[model samples]
Target: MKTQSVAIVLHDLRGGGAEKMMVRLANALAEQNTAVTMVLLTEGGVNKAELSSAVKLVELGSPRTLSSVPRLAAYLREAQPDRILSALTHVNVAAALACAMTGMLRRLVVSERNTYSLDKKVNTGAVMKFTYWLAPRIYRRLPNPVIAVSGGVARDLVETESLRPKDIVVAPNPVLTAKVLTMMDEPASHPWLQDPATRVVVAVGRLSHQKGFDTLIRAFAQVADIPNLRLVIFGEGELREELSALVSQLQLTERVDLPGYAANPLAEMKAADLFVLSSRFEGSPNVLVEAMATGVPVLATNCPSGPDEILDQGRLAPLVPVDNVNAMAQALRQCMEQPSDNAELKNRADRYRDALSAQAYSAVLNGSVTVWGR
Candidate 1:
């Protein structure tokens, strides 16, 4: 067998679910003695340090990916890796354009980590509309495999972009990692988590409209009068001020805490009584699976693509409608009353183990016939 050189391209090693998966895959490839290089279209992010020494890091140092096309094409022309994998919309488009410009024969794998149609539906702004308009044109013309992290995402591509099933590979996101297992045992420093009497509900994601943190805040407000309960959100994003104001408006200033971005959210998930995902839409949420891996019960808004598939139609965990405060509140009450069994939840999470996902991805990179994420 010959060693293969692989390049994983992304906008950044941001704390987003897709970024984390990219880092994990790159690390896994390195561990297998494959030459791995992480190509970032941007400079820095929280997960930058998470890469092991075995993997090379190349920063394009561009604020936006459009400006980085020449740099990306140049890197591809010079490095000439056997395979290239890129994630996210902007970065994927950039990778496609770069590969085209370089006219490289290297196999290119691009991923759509979100449901474009649903995301556009939720965010009906001019920018989002333009992005929706532009993405399909690019994806339709791309000649390589398009990785969709979930079946729903794959279906979206077929329906929205007119891509064939053969062109889309539905590979589930890698969830379990050695670091995650190690972190699960580590204690969370929050005072609420330490209290045996206190029931802490945790939600982790960027503070954005798509995440529906405001909806989660409102749902928590409905149950705030419950004794020994606290809502702690572990993330930071553009909506911090708006979400904080909603918390204040609901008079949950003391009961709810937005501690910004947590470097080690697994510890918090391990310690917390429950984990919730209130996203308006998601391709495939890593945190939902991570929370289940920790043996903590999960409550997620059954929004596009991921949560329903993850929760197995609400058999493993509870699901609510997107932005439905009353429904979310009711579901929260029911969850508090009858928590999910830890072992069962962990069993569900076991399906997305990193080893399995890594092997599937490795097969793709090595040009092996593979079927996954069915």
Candidate 2:
């Protein structure tokens, strides 16, 4: 075990749920005395700063997934990692190819962070479609079980991607790590959070069709008349103009605001009254867990993958139908009117502790364990 080293491959530490968890996982693995290296196709993202000093960062300096395969193989040949973990679909495919090129397929583990069916809906590029098409083929050929962030993602791999049940391992994202829980205690920078009189409804995600911010904005308009109510969506993406236009179209500009990328959404969540996840689909919905960890009331769209499991089938928090404006609106009103049990929320969030997530990954990489995130 002392001689073992793990290499985590991904497309830079971007501002995405999977990216955030991978960073936390790398940091946690380093803390456990495992030699860890983060191999990036590109070397920069907002989350890069969150990586621990102990974890080495390597840049392939390639533009995208397929182009980085040779560089990744070169890194593998030089570093000779005992195990490789890759996240996100494109990166997973690329890593598998790289591992295969280096004769290290048995040492590689691939993960699907979001529900692929939904991912396909949002990212419809011909190349992206081809990559998703290539994923199952590449993933199924690997010797190690594919790590999935949620049961839904696991199922999608089996159903949509044609992976065998024996090829799957469910692992929750490292959302409520001690570092993150501590970050939740940091001071809130948003002024809306400071006003106790204002009932703030916060949703954190990229402003893409997958996040369903347009649906959330429309839902917020339904309850906009509620005094002191305000909605703030955090994170940046390609659909900013479309979402902003919809917000204005609904005449919700006064009540709704799309504040771009938040370096520390948990801190803002700590101060907000409610946190909503309106994703069209998810693997584990890390933001939901983070909000619950902050003890903030949360509402989610009952999407294909993570929400039902994360919310314990709506026992932990309320879940609405995906893209149903009326149901989401009503849920929003009910959540805000009804104070949540902060203790219960935080306790539920603790199940995905960084230590536990890291332990599962470590075991998988060690080829000693199979199932997790139950």
Candidate 3:
């Protein structure tokens, strides 16, 4: 069988989860001999450096996602890729409109990387809120099922976005590449992570409210009695000043540190005593998966989607309620005292391996399979 020509539409090469996953999928598809082209709405993000040489990159030169629809439509008309995949809400809406204009709507597959309704939470600006509000209407025009990163996210689409159950497919985020496994063996990114004398609790994500780093910090303050225990959250965002203020207010200045974005979080996870994801909502947290892939113990909030599924309803690791400082504190104390089975965690992480996820997405992109029951 001949390989299909695929084009992935993304907002940018930003460090966000959706952007990272798209980059990995494009690279993996190219590595597997599929003709892959990445169509970025606007250029310039940290992930731009990570694109594989085999995969072609197309920069639309537009100022924003919606503004690129005309250019994207032109590309579809010219390149006429066999399959098209688009990520996130605004870009998905743009892709749907673009593909429709080019008479290629049937070839387009839009992916939802977060609980679709988080629009009410993540999109505060008027333009974004309206865009998200308009998404369901646009998504309904899709000829292909929307690919959700987790079952919870799929359910959200059906409930909030009014998508039919049959119109969604649950797919894993293509994390845990062979390169990540190698990176795990590298030295810890921070001196505290490398020090055997100190026990580190690591959380990686943007320092924003959605990530709930404030909850993590309060929980850490509650567990300060544990000697040699420290909390390190890696990632930068708009909430850096606010979160740093919280740390100071809680008097956790010494015990907690906000070391902005780690170049390789797996390396930090490899040396840590435990990993925590305190997100309020997630499609499927790649950081949690990365820690599990590193064979490190984890604790996460029982959010709408990803954590519960990844932890098997808390059978594999502890799951606390979102923003519940007491529950998070208790779990953190217990987890810091005793980590879970690394072998089992590693096994669960295997389900999201780059090869397996890439193959599933490949099937979707090629239209060889539909509704991969996840």
Candidate 4:
């Protein structure tokens, strides 16, 4: 077969779940001998270094998604890629409009990375709210396949966005990769990892309200009686000071560590005994799959869209309600006391290996399979 050209449209190379997944997918597709190009709306971002050398990077020069539409249309007219995959709502809307403006026939696949209706609770800015409100109208009119990271997210699209059920495809995020597995063995310099007597519980994500770090801190304080136990949260966001204040007020400052962001978090997760994801809601949590891939016992809040599906209906790991301090504390206590089967956790994580996801997406791009209706 002739080499197929693929382009991934993204807002930027930010340190978010969607950006990270797009980079991994671009790399994976390039490795498969598929010509991969990343069309970024903005300039340099934190994960810009993570892009594979084989993949081409196209910077649109526009600082905003809406402003980038003309640039995107120009690129589509010039490159005429075999397929285009866009991530998140704002960029997806831009991609759809760009394609309409350019009249390109390339297969366009837009992905939803979060439950937008739920995300409004954390970020209800006028622009974001209006964008999401207008998304369904644009998405419904566009003749493109939509990829939802989880079943819950797909349902949200249909129920909230009024999208057709047959138009959305449920594709979990690709997380487990050779690089990630190798990174797990890399040495971590954290004291909690170095101290053999220290029992560590780790959570990785932005330090924002959506991540529910405040709830995690309260839950950790409730379990302060568990000696030698430590809570470490990785990632940076707007709520760092608020979370820090809560930790200090609870008098658990010494026991909890908020080390901001780590470029290689898998190594730290591998060293920890337990992993927790306290998100208010998620599309498909990459951290959940990453923690499980490291053979670490995971305790995720049974948030909409990802945890229940990723955890095999709570068989792979313990699940708690979102923002429930008491439930999280109870689950944390029981999990700390038990021995989790590493092999089983690894098996669960295997379902989300990058190779499988890349192959599925490639098939979608190739139009060999219909990726709709659940």
Please report the candidate that would top lDDT against the real structure: 3
Local distance difference test, each candidate: 0.85, 0.86, 0.88, 0.85
Top-scoring candidate (TM-score): 3
Q: Per-residue alpha-carbon lDDT of model 2 for 1-374, expressed as tens digits?
A: 53279999989887677788899999988999899999998779988998999999998889877898899999899999988999988898888888889999988888888888778767779989999888888777778888888888888878876889998888778887777778988888778888889889999887777888888888889998899899888888899999888988888878888889776889998899899999887788888888998888888999988899888899888889988999999998899889678898888888899988888888888887668754
> Candidate 4, residues 1-374: lDDT per residue as tens digits?
34389889999998778898999889988888899999998777888998999999999879798889999999899999988899988898888888888776346878889986786555578877878877788777766567888888888889887899877777657798788889999877688977989999999988887889999999989898998999999888889899989989999889999998786899899899899999998888889889888888889999987889888789877899999999999999999998467789898788788887888777666655555223
Question: Candidate 3 local accuracy as lDDT?
Answer: 0.88
Q: Across residues 1-374, which tens digit of lDDT does each residue of candidate 3 receive?
A: 34478999998998788898888888888888889999998887888988999999999889988889899899889998988999988998899889889889888889989887874677888878888888888877677888889999999989887898988888888888878789998998698987899999999988878899999998899899999999999999999999999999989889899988787788999899999999998889998999998988999999988999999999999999999999999999899778899999999988887778888887776666655444
For model 2, the local distance difference test gives 0.86
Better by lDDT, candidate 2 or 1: 2
Every model's TM-score: 0.92, 0.95, 0.97, 0.95
Deviation of model 4 at 361, angstroms: 0.8
- Model 3: weakest 10-residue lDDT segment is 365-374
**Clashing pairs for predicted structure model 1, backbone only:** none
Q: Give the clash count for each candidate.
A: 0, 0, 1, 0
Model 1, residue 173: C-alpha shift (Å): 1.6
List candidate 2 segments past 4 Å from native. Answer: 1-3
TM-score, candidate number 3: 0.97
Give the better candidate number (3 or 4) by TM-score: 3
